[model samples]
Target: MKDLNKQFSLILLYALLFQGLYAVEIEFNADKTLLDSKKEILELEGNVSLKYQALIFEADKIFFDKKNDMFSGNELKFSSLDNFFYGAANIVEFSKTKLTLKEVEFSTCPCEEKIWWIESDEVSFNNEEKIVSSINSKIVVQGNTLAYLRKANFPISSERKSGILLPEIAINERSGLDIKVPVYINLRENLDLTIEPRIMTQRGYGLTNELRYLGKNHNGFFNSSFLQDDKESFQVLETDNLRWSFNFLHQQRLNKSTFFETNTSSTSDPFYLTDLGGFMSGLSRTLYLPQQASLSYFKKDFSMRLDLNSFKLTNPLAVNQFQRLPGLKLNYFFNKNNFKLVLNSDIAYFNKGGSFRNNEKESLSRVLFNPKASYLYNQKNYFLESSISLLYQFKNHQGNKNTELSPLFELNNSLKFFKLSKTTKIILEPYINVAFSDQKKIINKLKIDSGLRFNPFKHKQQFGSLFLSNQKDIMIGTKLTHTDKANNHFKFEIAKLSTLGQKILFIEEKRIDLPEPFSLKLKYKTNNGIIFKSHLSLDSKNNFNLTSNSISLNFNKYKILIGHYFARNIEIYNLNNNSLEQKKINSFEFSASVHLAKNWSGGFKFINDLEQKKNVNSVLSIDYENKGMVVGLAYMKSLELDWVSILENDTFKDYHKDRFRLFFELKGLGSIGKPKESYLKRRNL
Candidate 1:
């Protein structure tokens, strides 16, 4: 009889737990609970817990109104797998569709210190809508107040919605006291925009707007910035009072074989890229901004492309660029029974404009057709290949029309000699290339492209020519590769070219004498994770001068590099005496990166000028990343070229003022300062 009475009491509790909906399950436990049956009220105290669906609520004291599915408590906590809330609240209204807690301190972090958190006067969550709304909220980081919002709403879903983004704060020598606020607008499912306003104490106010769109067949983005220059900064620069920049990129697919892409970028002032580009893009040293569009089609055996390119010269050292009104290229390939054939055609019209030097304007139109054939014979230890190409070109340079025909023939042979041992294997490959070209008419003209020629032997020349030269040439090269049983590998290559006739170098049709250089390159990797690579070139005909050299070593988490380049400044006179100019060597560069500690790394890069006997560029950086935070410090001082040649034909190198930066960041949050290039390079990021 007593068991039957307890079962009746449990049935009564379940009936009272739910209101106006089906009784879905609800589990309740409390140390001390009191029931007022007349008022449909339940009071609980001392370690109370209520479980509903995937959510659980715990409190030290609780009062439940069974009729309305509401709970009022002190020291309340609610949690799920992904969400958690805790606070001292007087009331928590819970229902099938919503959960509301008044006066709560909330945090996403589970650590004891709670590195970051949000505090609100009232927080509400709508379960059906999957959104959280808070009124009068404060965001604190490391016990410091970061931001205060009157009202904020965040959507739990991953899809972007209109909300307040975190503000950005940074300080630098160039732009002091930088602060930016961004507003995001979701215009459609596939389109969005952001408006960012920035204030710089040393500079002025700026507004940047970005628009992005994604579609089934096309996607693109456009970004623009306008800054009102501060009077102080204007006085220092002595130039523009208003600064602006723009960037646009797009890609579209018309069909399976056709596509289009465009890239356009521009800025108002010459110093914009140097001064503010670090904040804009990684390509901060760009001298010219190119605006280009390309359309391409590809199939099994044929491919074609049309390109339109123009450039905006933003630096004094940059020369005028030729605009391709529309350049077209087509190629076809065929293969049958060890025989390969290729046909290529190019048509272009180039026009030069803008404030070019000497106020010179010129235009050129060119057409080229090249056909090539090749035969290949392959074997286990040797390979032999021969190719022939005929190139025909027609050019109209400012209405001065000319035609040129060139024919090329190439023969290549590759022979390998191998020695195998129980624990080591070595292979020596000796390659020979013989070619002849009869380029006559268009050799003196500046061209848009180097037309297709004989292949299977297109090795790089140590002293490459600006203009392709007619030559009967023979190149001899050999490579030695060794591999051990432990998988360590080493490779070495050496090559030289011999011309049947005197090789003539051209600088805008002005002939210069050339002395052959010997080039050698080597690379090695050990089984114990050590790497070594080096490149060296020597001009034996010119007093054994070291033309170029570079070496690098890597072991474990450390790397070191050294490089040098020497220039043999040749002198020429107009039908006058020949004088020898002193050989000048460029700066010697040394850089190293080392792992300092378990979580710390450091790097240093230096360039020493051989002539000046001083440092040209030096950079040092140290970084630490741990526990969702990153800290970095860097210092840099480098020489920069200042070209005053437009007004006076002179150039001067001046060292940039020494600068240092301190960077700090928290994961999923904002950072404080910019990380310089050396820091990024050392980390390979």
Candidate 2:
């Protein structure tokens, strides 16, 4: 009997090897075997294992039919050679193109741990399509059933597939309960779309759609949202029942040396962002939504660009800003030896939508031409550069034309000294710049983008001094810097400006007092990740007229930041009263983030209006993350200045908004809530 069994097994092995020659190469092992050569059927009992290509199969008993080129097994277990997928089934049928299983369990997790898995009545994998489909599937996590589906399909490859994504849930005071379910559509290999329907218990239903496309030289996206009617719109005094917003962004390479880009955003109403929250909502004092487009061309020594820019104000009561309908800029550079020549030219038309103060809508056209030549001499220890430039500007406002021409001369010198050692190195640099421009009458001139630079010390170049204001001036600035191999850096800079031929400075069409002439800047960085920075402008009395300082410390596990800003007795022309007014500003800001424990973190941020003795904005958050999950909670409080009202006592009172956010995510699945960090990141915190 033993000899007969061995002979049958040998015959079966020969038959299997013969079959593999015509199809995929197959290897098999079994304790018992039977062969029916007339039927072309091979049966194996006891421990049986088979492998073909990257696929592996194991079972207690199995049968292979050479005529049908198929395999059938009971109590089957199968996996890929890379172990990317593994599953077990009660009954299995395997072929070259497809694998079918009945009463199956499958997962991407490790077989030994099985952190999560799926059980289905039937499942099939299409090798050609690289997809897995199942019927009556149950998702199991930690041995507990989490969800059930009648039918489901997922891609086994990295390609994107059209499907319903995970939904998002959020609760806040203004919106009550908010839920969004997004559907993703893969229309083509280079095109996709996402449609998200949203509902709020307190607000009305809304829909958001995003379409994106990619090409060989271009990529772009269009995102838009619409709400039928907002229940809370009345709070902002908005009568429109429909609220909508749209944003379009695109970039394209026209050729090897040319590119074009556009980014535009608009909303049905100014309060749309405040009520529903949009891009850059929390990060910046976003008073305007930008609409801009540009085309640029570059070459070895020349460049040209054309731009169209506009802005939509977020507050109706705020002053209207200037818009550059069409602007053209051109630059030409020539370098030979240590001598260089450059030309910069710009032309633009500016228009304002609304009148300022009580005047009519303003429109202007400007043309500016600047040409410069410079010579640079460099050595290992010293460097010197001298430049001469001319600026000519022509402007036509309401048919009132004016032109100005000025000559500028500048000299820059720097000396460097260094000491090197095996373990440490030190370096010091002293730099000075002297710039002189022939002053001209800038009074009664329309100010178009030129103004007094509050922090001139930050601008070290002679070009910056020439462009600081319309009126010509003499600027002298010096800076000293020190650095060491220990990662320590220190810098000190001071600059003073003397008006050459002008008495008054005009900014934004308003006459203003000259800012402090002496500006000072300081910065220090330490090896332990501490940084300190300060900028101050001192009056003739040597008192700080404008001060801004910040300190921060950063480490692997924690961070801290603090800042203060103060402007003393700033003077500006009040259009309503037609008189100069004095204003003072004082503010403080603080932020910190720390790791509380393993897998836990916490953060806090606050901005205080010291002048008003009130908190402007504050946020606190706590988060926890594990191997496959993340959960977080955050609280926020912010004062809204646009929502102010006049009390019966004739005093203005502002409004404060409070909100709480929750976030939860499950790895390999979907998320449950909006992430708190996303909101903070939008504010650039």
Best by lDDT: 2
| Cα-lDDT of candidate 1 | 0.68
Candidate 2 residue pairs in backbone clash? 282-683, 283-683
Candidate lDDT scores, in order, read 0.68, 0.71
- Model 2 C-alpha lDDT per residue in residues 190-260, reported as the tens digit of each score: 99999989898888788888999999999999888888766854546767787788888899999999999
| Weakest ten-residue segment in model 2 by summed lDDT | 642-651
lDDT (C-alpha) at residue 575 in model 1: 17
Candidate 2 deviant stretches above 4 angstroms: 1-90, 94-97, 107-114, 127-129, 279-285, 354-360, 449-503, 507-509, 517-537, 540-553, 562-588, 611-614, 640-656, 679-685
TM-score of 2: 0.81
TM values, all candidates: 0.79, 0.81
lDDT for each residue of candidate 1 in 58-109, tens digit (9 for 90 to 100) = 8887787767767787777776535533334567776667777787776544
